[model samples]
Target: MRNRTLILGVTALAVAVTGLAAPSFAARDKMTPEQRAERMIKRLDTNSDSKVSLDELQAHMTANFKAFDTNGDGQISADEMQAKRQAFRDARKAWQEAKSKDGKERDAALAQLKDARPAMVPGMRPKAFKRVDADGNGSLSAAEVASASEKMFKRRDKNGDGVIDAADFTKKI
Candidate 1:
């Protein structure tokens, strides 16, 4: 009996050590341009349509804004992000209670809410025009325009390139 207990304790300690050494699931993975484009396409094609029309992209963006823009303002402030998180939690609880929905409807509703926020105000960081002009030719192509977006509530991308995925805003740092 003592031998079995010792073995169990050793196994538990090994498992605990393994868990501590395990890599985080959220760590970033390098993606090829094609892979990045595919992810962008997947996100934009919310309706599962093989192709995303301009209007569909706009609609999807609007919904996203509503979820993150808690203040109902055009931009996502820090406070607004907290509020949105709480609201999401509440909605999730309600959704769990219903159990009839797979949360698809809840997600759709949240997306629609964000879409209702005003078109991003002027002078927004990571300016939309900047993002679209990826080659600095001062022209935005349909594909280029599709991927430009805001990260957090501040950093904005004018071009949808995956190169600027880092969140660091400071140039020198």
Candidate 2:
């Protein structure tokens, strides 16, 4: 009779734990690719114009570059970039460590981290810096940034509509 009571208590605890963890899994599964793209376009469409223009792209890139510069030096050095990368890696490692006790949770955290990795880090490498520097100045100027942004804007404007909207990222159903 005592064994039966202990088994029931353990089963109840298991069910409670499972219920508590289910919502996070469900929320992550609910966002479709189209929804995610729409959210991104909405975010980047700073003027609420429902589309992203070359000017807007350049503005966004300028802001991001300033953020990466960290010391207001008007240039992102190797040390600054390395610091950003290290911060990202450390955060990812801490997240993984926090989930170490639960295999499913750890896997989910890892997958999310992988998906959220920055898209621009590789473009900040030495070769890319040389390409963006344009005049071999060893640093990027506002003009150089605008030029790079123009190239990105052209590439992202897939239909050549002169602006990037959800259509640029979404596929036809």
Candidate 3:
């Protein structure tokens, strides 16, 4: 009789855990790569023209720079950049902590996280800005932003279609 009760308790615990984890699994499953790319394109294509132009990209990047410039100083200082990096790390740690408790699920989640790491992060922003800072001005000007945007557009528009659209994100597989 004791063994039967213990087995029921364990089964109940497993069911509760599984129930709690179901939503996260479902959410992750629903976010396909195409959906993610479309979301990004929508966000970057500010004019809703179904394509991302250099002007749109530059505007977005400039806005991001302003956001990171906590002091409204028109430049991102090392301290501001460090704060951004810390925030990113904290968020990533929280995400990892919220991942599945089951070993297999946890491993899969970690693998997915590794695969989905962004090509650019706040920590890399300073270096990226330096690359964009033409004339060694130590700061990004509007012209530099436009130039950088043009370069980025060229790189992302793999087919050289003059604009970034859904085709740029398509995989050949």
Candidate 4:
């Protein structure tokens, strides 16, 4: 039972990193699940010949895990997790502060705060993502889809070259 609990906890952490690093949740809405799977295959298929080798999978997972292991430790503890979540929240707040009031964009921007609110508090299940869930299942939850109509203003740092597109910056300004 202890081992199972550890495994589930590890899996949940993997899911969080994988989910956050995943193609923007907003983009997933435009394509069907099948299409998204295909895209993932292409993205993960690093060799470009046409398939995902187990090595590639391991490399991807390791890279993502390392990304969160900010302290260079071999493990991701609750503190590390909280640090990551805080980083996301900080970015969200900065972006929110930059937006204007009285428009669809503002409404959309505010929803990120709404989506991440549950995480902000000590213990509250998020409501914004649930509001968008179509099947009422325990899937599809993240501030990534904060607002369905919100436009994507930033280029995703898909390549992970230490920059979001060209700028090595975030919404800090």
Candidate 5:
């Protein structure tokens, strides 16, 4: 029971520990690219320098890995990954049901689920996981997570500035 609570807390923190006041889940859908960048920066920028360094990004990604590696196994299994997915599916189901109700009830449900925030791990698809799991061992380790995060940080640092800022998130339409 305690482990579950700890996992939930860490999972929440890893996904979106927005230091600033974050937008509603509904508003998040409407957020512009620049806005999304700023929100991500607020969550990932540990030093509060308005940007995300590779170290900061890897730290957050490692935290996510820890959360996914429930049971303190130091590696993530298919079961653990599916469990996170199931939680989001359950929340999403409830949210859809609540959508048929009156405005207040729908809004209340949205608040509780926050658009099924549990599965917000970036690019959580099987292909992405395989790419990260360099050993092909069918489980993910902390080292794989570190390597993947470094790659992710470099990919997002579009301007080659060594850190990710609003510019990375923004795109010219």
Candidate 6:
């Protein structure tokens, strides 16, 4: 009875440790380029039609155009793109200021933010902004975006199968 009790306790502890080391259930998780494309195509085909109609395509495109046309001119120019980026900076500054205005010296907070820069630069644009901006909208949206996400998974898959295996995420971004 004593030996059986010790084994059960060890097993329970091991199970608990394994659970703690695993990823949480709520993670949206990163997807490969091919997965991204396949998902986009699925989303675009909302009605399950084999092909996406011009109207559906147009709706998606128009929504994307509106996002990059910051000046409401129905076109996205370089200047407008710059303005949008500046706006994001301003918003971040304002949010940080508001959160830390309790008479705290912000040097440490600012330094921490600076350390987070390298990762953020890539997020500002999806690939080369100009190349992916198929319609020259200066930004990307579902319509302007390409389906290369699934390709990312394919490159990591190694087996060429459509599905990504659990161990393939070791080198994921």
lDDT of 2 by residue, 66-118 (tens): 76677887776667766766766875885668675677777766776664454
RMSD for each model, in Å, please? 11.3, 8.7, 10.2, 23.8, 17.9, 11.2
Candidate 5 per-residue lDDT over residues 85-118, each given as its tens digit: 7877887788989998999988978886874465
Better of 3 and 4 by TM-score: 3
lDDT of 6 by residue, 1-173 (tens): 99999999999999998897665543347666656655655655546743344454445545545665666755556565566666657655755875655544466446544543221111135445576556665644443432322233356455444433433334453
Quote the RMSD, in angstroms, for model 3.
10.2
For this target, which candidate reaches the highest lDDT against the unseen true structure? 5
What's the best-to-worst order under lDDT?
5, 2, 3, 6, 1, 4
lDDT tens readout by residue for model 4, 127-170: 54344443465333222222221211122333444222222133
Best by TM-score: 5
Clashes of 3: 0
lDDT of 3 at 91: 54
TM-score of each: 0.31, 0.61, 0.55, 0.38, 0.69, 0.37
Q: Write down the TM-score for model 6.
A: 0.37
10 residues in a row with least lDDT, candidate 2? 114-123
lDDT per residue for candidate 3 within 1-173, as digits (tens), equals: 99999999999999999999999889886987778878878888888888888777777877666656668867655566667667666656745885857777667666655543333322347778567766675655545655666777798888887888889888861
Residue 3 displacement (Å), model 1: 41
What 10-residue stretch in candidate 4 is worst by lDDT? 144-153
Better of 1 and 3 by TM-score: 3
Model 2 vs truth, CA RMSD: 8.7
Clashes of each: 12, 0, 0, 0, 0, 12
Best first by TM-score, ranked: 5, 2, 3, 4, 6, 1
Off by over 4 Å in 5: 1-29, 99-116, 119-123, 170-173
The true-versus-predicted C-alpha distance at residue 137 of model 6, in Å, is: 13
